[model samples]
Target: MKLAIMQPYFFPYIGYFQLIHAVDRFIVYDNIKYTKKGWINRNRMLRDGKDVIFTLPLKAAPDSLDICERSLSADFDRNKLLNQLHGAYRRAPFFSDAFPVLEQAIRFPNDNLFSFVFNSITGICDYLDIKTEFTISSEMAIDHNLKGQAKVLALCEKASADVYVNAIGGIELYPRDAFAARDIELKFVKSKPVEYVQFGAEFVPWLSIADVIMFNSANEIQENMLGEYELV
Candidate 1:
């Protein structure tokens, strides 16, 4: 079986989905230390031909905690933020068809960011009709170390994955010889730019998937155009 592991992100970009789509089982690594400026809580959107970013405010987050254990800000104003998203993309040509779904997704009742993120991802999976099984890396019983390549290899052994798939960002973190020692094939996914016409302007590459979902229906977005990655 194929497997990929990554941190849980809030309404992340297309590269996130591409990684999930390319693997049979995808693991969300919630046990690692959470970085303050990572995609864990924010993503970019388009507004008036410019980029606008939306983020989930956190409350009393510790510098040592991983994203999985981080909490949302107590002062979070869900309705107000929802309105900002609507105001930003409501003018896009396909907004009429896509806003309701995104609005519903952002307004989901849960306050915990992790639960909120997982639900949002599941909702997107439903919208696209993707059937890949999602799992948590912390829940597995792996035998390798949690630092660097040992962590990945350990997770792979726990998942019983023959081919371990990961994002291109790990080009330096992973050791090919280590995976080969474990008899597991390693494949990296290089997600290409997904372009769409927004408001009849010049096409830009790599807008967040949330932006796409805000401008197009799930059915329209479900059509995977550039497709998956192939390693050399």
Candidate 2:
């Protein structure tokens, strides 16, 4: 089986989804440390013909805690976020069909940060018709204490993965020789240029998968956007 692993992200970019779609199984990391200013709870969206960031507010907590250990802020206004999305994409072409998915993800009642983001991811994958199986890293029997490539190798071994794929951003972080030694092939996914109308402006790239959905039909996304990637 081909496997890929990544931290749960809130409405991450298309490349992230491409990585998931490129693999047979995807492992979402809930056991890792929560990142203070990363995509764990935030993502970019296209607003006013420019890129803007929208975030899920989290309660105060130590940065060292795992993502599964964190919780959403008690006072997080789901309506406010929905309103913000509506304000931004209300004019989008496919708003009627796509808005509901975003609403469901934002209004998800779960307080755990990982659950919230995982809901967002799975919801979109369903809409896109991605059939890849999912695994939670913490649920695996591998030693969670290992870090870096050691941890990855352990997870791959546990999954009986024949090949491991990753996002292009990590090309420098993983050394191919090590995987070769383990009889596992390592490859990187790079999204080819995917452009579509956004109010007919010049065009903004990598806003969010949410942005992509707002402007394209499910058929368009599944047939064009999802497969618009190459394994490098």
Candidate 3:
């Protein structure tokens, strides 16, 4: 089986989904520590033809907490977030179709950071018709104490995966020789250039999947963006 694992992220860029599409069992890491600098609770979105970062408000807590342990701030205003998205993409052609999906995801009634993000991701995947199976790392039988590439290898072994797919950026983190020693193939997904009309404005690349969904239909995304990458 092909496998890939990554920390949960908010509606991330198209490359994130490309990683999901490349694997059979995609594991989402929730037992991992929450990093303030990471893209766990934040992602970029298109605003006025420029990329802007939107963050999910998390309650003030020690940075060492696991992602599942983090709580959404009490003051998280779902409407405000929805309004921000609506205002930004109101004029886009696919907004009518995409808004419902985005609204359902944002309005998911969860206060835990990981749960909220997971709901959004799965919902978006359903909308895009990507049927890859998902697994939560915390619930797996593997040793949870392992770190870095060791943790990944443990998960791979536990899942009996013959090939492990990862984002291109992970090439440095996971050496091919290491996986080869274990009789597993390691491949990196390099996303090709993804360009689509953004209401005639200068195209801003790598915005959130929210931006992509707003402008492109599920069919367009599935046909072009879903397979628009190379495994190297």
Candidate 4:
């Protein structure tokens, strides 16, 4: 089986989904330590023809707490986020079709950070018609203490994966020789440049998947998803 693993992210960019779609099984690495200023709880969105940021508030926890152990702040108002998205993308061509999916995802009842983000990720995948099987790292039997490539190899072993696919950014982090020695092929996926009309302005790239869904139909988006990457 082909496998890919990544930290859970809230409304991540299209490349994130491309990585998930490229693999047979995608693992959400929720047992890892939470990092400040990371993409785990925040992502970029397009507003007024420019990039803007949005984030999920989390309850205070030790810096070392695993992502699965963290909780959303009780003070987070789901309606406020929905309002923000509506205000920004209400005029988007496909808002009516896309907003309900975003609403259901953002309003997920679980306050745990990982659970909320995982639901959002899976929710979007469903809308996009991606059927890759998902696994949670915390539920896997592999030793979780191993860092970097060691942990990745262990997880691949546990999954019986002969091919390990990762986002292109991981090229420098994983040694090709090590994976080759284990009879596992390592490959990276680089998303081809994708552009679409957005309010008749110069295209903004790398916005959240929400923006893409708002401006494009499900079929168009799915075609873009399947055609927008090359394995390197």
Predicted candidate 2 versus true structure: per-residue lDDT over 110-172, tens digit per residue: 999999999999999999999999999999998899998899999999999989999988899
User: On residues 6-40, what C-alpha lDDT tens digit does candidate 1 reach at each position?
Assistant: 88877778777877888899888767787877887
List pairs with backbone clashes in candidate 3.
none
**Better model by TM-score, 1 or 2?**
2
Residue lDDT tens for model 4, 93-199: 99999999999999999999999999999999999999999999988998888998999999999999999999999999998889988889999999999888999
Q: What TM-score would you give candidate 4 relative to the actual structure?
A: 0.98
- How much is 63 displaced in model 1, in angstroms? 0.6
Stretches of model 3 off by over 4 angstroms after superposition: none
RMSD of each: 2.0, 0.8, 0.7, 0.8
Per-prediction TM-score to the true structure, in the order listed = 0.91, 0.98, 0.99, 0.98
Best model number under lDDT = 3
Off by over 4 Å in 1: 143-145, 226-228
lDDT of 3 by residue, 122-226 (tens): 999999999999999998998899999999999999999999999999988888999999999999999999999998989999989999999898999999899
Query: Ten residues in a row with the worst lDDT in model 3?
Result: 44-53
* Global Cα lDDT for candidate 3: 0.94
